[model samples]
Target: MLAFYPRFIRTFDDLPGQLSLLIHAWNGCNMRCYGCHNADELIAKPPKDHLSGAQVVERLSGYDAMFDAVLFSGGEF
Candidate 1:
């Protein structure tokens, strides 16, 4: 079986009341919609450093106790 990996460019909304993590899955996007911040990152394929599903779970597992929920954004599946 293949190994799992997870990568996030950065996180936001790290306030005391709301503990949320913004996860960036793939940089490769099929659509070129307007007002897109990750336009540059989108390509034919996501970078090798891109995170995987299992990796994401592991990263967020630690925050499960502190955070209410994880918000996944950037790049469409």
Candidate 2:
């Protein structure tokens, strides 16, 4: 499976001191729904470069003081 995703999706929140992080697990989906932009690489397993749980926590930890909260989004969370 391929591992690729956008850096972040814009948020609509108007609150101050807020930051959003869009993390892609890169775990391909089983569904074959039409019009899926990521359909080409859909599979049962995630790519070898997919970040582990600990790595994810560590990645988010860096933004602890800068962001109020982090949002996890992907084909599934």
Candidate 3:
């Protein structure tokens, strides 16, 4: 894993009526797709405030009831 910070909670308009939590679990990328918005940050250095896998799961578990689905976002999968 590149980096992790699981304390954040965000809602996105996926398809007008659908809303989901956008999980930002990692940073930096290897693919480097053209015109990607995260290219700058991904190419730079990984964040120092990242979390561990167990911590990520624990943090996410706190908001389990608030959302029906999750979206693993940021950089590569």
Candidate 4:
């Protein structure tokens, strides 16, 4: 199983399709629905740990040439 991270960024090379950056927007959720995939992270993440807009952009700067699209993931905005 893959361990979750609040700002997880990943890329897949073997998969067919446009190259993309998979970014987990946040490690949080507003509901406690049964069997949620991120249940553990939702309960464990601290709000203060979330990255600011500038930080996210900085982190993604190097990826500009690496992907053809950005796929944002995570629950809640």
RMSD of each: 4.5, 5.9, 2.9, 6.2
Residues 1-77, candidate 4: write the lDDT tens digits.
12223455456652457776765555454566677665565466544556655676777887688778777655655
Query: In model 2, which residue pairs have backbone atoms overlapping below 3 Å?
Result: none
Q: Which stretches of candidate 3 lie over 4 Å from their true place?
A: 6-9, 41-45, 75-77
Q: Which candidate gets the maximum lDDT versus the true structure?
A: 3
Candidate 3: clashing residue pairs, number: 1
How close is every model to the real structure, measured as TM-score? 0.57, 0.49, 0.64, 0.53
Q: Evaluate model 4: give its lDDT.
A: 0.59
Query: Could you give candidate 3's per-residue lDDT for residues 24-77 as a string of tens digits?
Result: 656655566678654555346555677776777777787778877777656566
**What overall lDDT, based on C-alpha atoms, would model 1 receive against the true structure?**
0.56
Superposed Cα deviation of residue 53, candidate 1 (Å)? 0.7
The per-residue C-alpha lDDT of model 4 at residue 3 equals 24
lDDT of each: 0.56, 0.52, 0.63, 0.59
In terms of TM-score, how similar is model 4 to the real structure? Answer: 0.53
Clashes per candidate (backbone, < 3 Å): 4, 0, 1, 0
* lDDT (C-alpha) at residue 47 in model 1: 62
